[model samples]
Target: MADKNTQVQLARQPDGEPKVSDFQVAETDIPAAGPGKFLARNIYLSLDPYMRGAISGRHMGHSRLNQGDLIGGRCVAQVIESKHAEYAEGDYIVIESGWQSYCVSDGAAKDGVRKIDPNAGPLSAALGVLGMPGLTAWAGVEKLADPGLGDTFVVTAAAGPVGGTAGQLAKAKGCRAVGIAGSDEKCRIVVEEYGFDACVNYKNDDWEEALKEACPDGIDVYFDNVGGPILDTITQQLNLYGKIILCGLVSQYNRNDDNDFAGHNMGPFVGKRAQLLGLVVYDYYDQMDEFLRAAVPLVKAGRLNFHEDRADRIEDAPAHFAKLMSGQNVGKAMVTIGPESL
Candidate 1:
């Protein structure tokens, strides 16, 4: 077995989007677990847009990062050693293992760390389709937006993990799902792979007019993942009592120094009388079982589809993360820390 002390640390505060220089790889002596403690080795590190907020110390509820601190996020790992009764050696688990190769946890008592089924498709799926991103799409569309059959539903960042999943779920619910993405290729994938009724490329010159044309009946439900011009455009076409689920704001994540949305066009919000809501997937953890029960079958039966954009090594995390923030990645972006086999 490899030595357990190796780890990575946050090197500095990111100015705009994060760069490789902001991270520092380190090696330390692994500590033995005391009673009720366990040791885990990270296998897959999830690359998410929210991590961009965490890196900048701009998060609303939690305290921001201090310089040179360990940068942390969700990861799938295997327990290599265990002093805790609930966990055993060789158990595959999900935990807040950070960007490091190994982690120490106080078993199930810790905020993170749950045993995952190794038989489940790919281990990385725990961070993508079967994990937080998937749950976000399911819950946001089914419970929050409550899109009905034949309703015109719009989703921004449409080719991304959350947006793609949301579009599929909306279609499964019998709605006319419209996807808005940055590139023409992504727009095509959203329509062809995810079954979106229509896709609009936000990078196009007549994108706004195209969006208006696509949703002639007005948008009954809007899933806002990129909240700059896309949100502005969608709001303009919202129908009465339209539901808007706010998932993320990737359009502004790269602008860490700014505190203003002065450039946003907010004229549509006033006119539409739409309902806009911010969603954090963790708040609905209690519904995870319900989500899994519903989603697993669909995924197993091929009724639900998910895609992944992956970088090969842990060292590539910062770069891959930047791509996600820049809207350059389609579907869920992930970093492989060690060997590919789970």
Candidate 2:
């Protein structure tokens, strides 16, 4: 076992988009499992856009971070030492381990620790497709929108886990799945890999027209991830009585001031009779088993797919996160902390 645990810490709060200088790497004694606690070495750390707001206390239910605090995140880990009854040595689990090599937890529900099923899929996938992002997609598609066969389902951030997965799920339900993405590469990945009907590159000046061409039947369901003027633009194309699942706001996550957020006009929504359902993944934690039961088989069959953009080590987390916030990462962004197995 290593003598020290290497961790990424907050050096300073970011002004707008985060920079590598906002983080510092440090070494500390590897934590020991105390009474009713377990110690696990992290193997994969998930980097998400939400952490940008989380560290700054801009995200819901998150406190502002202080200097020297471990950067908060989720990780796939292996339990090496345990005094807890529910977890034992060699158990593969996902937990709120933050951006570090090792973590100690009391097997608490509040910690969001979940044992892994090696048979389900890749361990790293527990942090991506078959994990929280996938669950969020499932909830939005299955629970809220519930688009009918041949209904038009359009999603933004189409190459991301939530967007890609939502599009695929809607496609499987026989809905025409159209994706709107930032780049042509992302559009290709969403259309070719995730099997969306068509993908529109939002960066193109003619993209909204392209979206209109793709969804000639009219958009019945809109799975929104990036909220901005784009949301308003898309709403103009939504069919009467359409549904909108408000999943994420990546566009506003890096804003240094709240006033920078653009306000939406409700007049259009009132005219369209659109049903806006806000999504918060925390509300669906209990339905994880139900999600995995449906997702695992599709994942194994290659029907549901995912891509990853990863860094070699924990020290790269800040850079990777910066890339994600800048809308540069092509897929799910993560860091490898340790080998999957010892």
Using TM-score, give the best candidate's number.
Answer: 2
Judged by whole-model lDDT over C-alpha atoms, candidate 2 comes out at 0.93
**What 10-residue stretch in candidate 2 is worst by lDDT?**
107-116
- Candidate that would win on lDDT: 2
TM per model? 0.94, 0.99
> Between which residue pairs do clashes occur in model 1?
none
Cα deviation of 216 in candidate 1 (Å)? Answer: 3.1
Residue pairs clashing in model 2 are: none
Question: Model 1 over residues 15-127: C-alpha lDDT tens digits?
Answer: 77677787777777776778888887788889888777777667665456766677777898888789988899889888987877778889653447777887765788888
The candidate 1 region of ten consecutive residues with least summed lDDT is: 258-267
How close to the true structure is residue 262 of candidate 1, measured as C-alpha lDDT?
Answer: 45
Q: What would the per-residue lDDT of candidate 2 be over residues 35-111, giving only the tens digit for each residue?
A: 99999999999999899999998888889999999999999999999999999999999999999999999988767
Q: How close is candidate 2 to the true structure, as a TM-score?
A: 0.99
